[model samples]
Target: MTRSRLTPEREAELYNAVLDLLREVGYDALTMDAVAARTRSSKATLYRQWGSKPELVAMSLRHSKPVDISQIDTGSLRGDFHEMVAQSDDCQMERDTALVRGLSRAVHENDDLLQALRELFIEPEITGLDTMLQRAIARGEIAADNPALKYLSHMLVGAFVAHPLINDEPMTQDFLRDYLDAVMLPALGLPAPGV
Candidate 1:
């Protein structure tokens, strides 16, 4: 069965159903049967569209989001960084949590799934951050080739997402602010005023 057989509307409905299931039951517990039941589609239809569970999950995640990397001029690098940090205080966090957990489970077990997710979900965010940093450089807010910019992307997100999982605490806005001020900005070669 080819994707051409399924209308665009039908595909979107099925994908949205998968996202809903992901939010409700998480990735580990999600199953083709469950998705079929939730979407009111036959399991064979899902199999035809996506050969395996990981493939289905990967496709669902790819379709479920529009990555936002818009220019946010906050008048200063600090303000821009703060705005960027603050943007994650919504559904994006929940989606990232689910994607990270799901991808982590699959990374060691399934190479194809791991590669698909790295290409689809992870690389885009990294590239977007790089673009943001480039814009900052072009604006003279930072050096054109700041070394810390090379690492700020991972530090900003990894600290929030990975550290909490390591230490067993929920990520919060205050923690995000603290991390941005103490870790991210400094790493990006920006110090607080009069420092």
Candidate 2:
């Protein structure tokens, strides 16, 4: 990939424009021309930086995430997770959910998109969660090499998708706390905070 001479500020603008267009028009419908017009950059620049629509959107999705999973420790696993969950920005979450909804159809059929989603979106969060689990194991809170370690992050994220589908509730902090107690902790052989 050719290096972009664009400043960090300019690069962020392009990423934001890509996500904004993805939310508005979706992956298949989102054209490089539209992104260029929206970001006020030339089509040649975007093509040079990202090479294709899939690559542009992939890079945008990767950049949108808060990649710093540092500073998550609060001693206990549940405590760490509660802190993580409590940090949710509802508006951002809603935007992300909408982005997924918009791209779901095309994502499933397109190999490039599926690879991008896993590499850029899914793997980073999972890596963060895996780091958290490793910390807990070091503290003797969780057994090292526990099988549940692998699926923990997926389940935590999947809960958000499942909650709205099975019930009429949004993933408010209160409900997620309950879910942590009722579902997550029990599955990992950990007790809820008060229990």
Candidate 3:
């Protein structure tokens, strides 16, 4: 669907309002009326722009992403990964982690939301990550056929969800940097930091 061309500032405002409502009410209880009220936009305008709550929520999540993984090219996979982690702020990561955790149950139950998320958020992220990995392969940093590439996305997502659950701590930049150095880089056959 072609999105309505709102000004970037207006679009960001709407996305922020949607995310705030989602945080306050949860996905199951969030409504277009609530979003309209919060953003001072009409229900028709929201529907015209996004088509549904699922799409709106998905787009909002996409808008809130801190870094574009595809753009990082530090001449080495390790540097690229570390740069990606460094671009994210610890407090913002905590908030985003909490938001995703809240949406997780709703995403599982709502097929529309799941599809929207896959289309609007997950696929683009995967494509960017694939680009980064492909660059690494071309640079001889990792084998193109490395089996680790197959499970990379799963491992990353599992790390995001599992960190808070297992460690009872927010997924900070430091933790992500450590994870890349200890787990992901090793799996992809990259040398450990300082080695």
> Against the true structure, what is each candidate's TM-score?
0.75, 0.88, 0.96
lDDT of 2: 0.80
Residue-wise C-alpha lDDT for candidate 3, range 1-195, written one tens digit per residue: 566568889999999998888878899999999999888889998999999999999999999987788998999899998898888799988888888888999989999999999999999999999999999999888999889998988988888899999999999999888998999999999878888
Better of 2 and 3 by lDDT: 3
Candidate 3 C-alpha error for residue 54, in Å? 0.6
Candidate 1, residue 30: the lDDT equals: 84
* Model 3, runs deviating above 4 Å: none
lDDT of 3 at 68: 81
Give the 10-residue window scoring lowest on summed lDDT in candidate 2: 62-71
Model 1 lDDT tens row, 1-195: 368878889898988888778777766688899999988889998898887777777777777655455465666777866777677664566566665665566578778767767776667767776777777788787897677777776686587568568867666666677777887777777885458
Model 1: weakest 10-residue lDDT segment is: 64-73
Index of the highest-lDDT prediction: 3
Each model's lDDT: 0.73, 0.80, 0.91
**Model 3, position 137: C-alpha lDDT score:** 96
User: Residues 1-195, candidate 2, lDDT per residue (tens digit)?
Assistant: 865598989999999999999988878889999999999999999989888788788788888875445468888888887887667666766676677667778888789888877887778767787788888888998887667777777777687777766785555677778888888877777876677
| Per-residue error (Å), model 3, residue 82 | 0.9
Indicate the TM-score of model 1. Answer: 0.75
lDDT of 2 at 112: 88
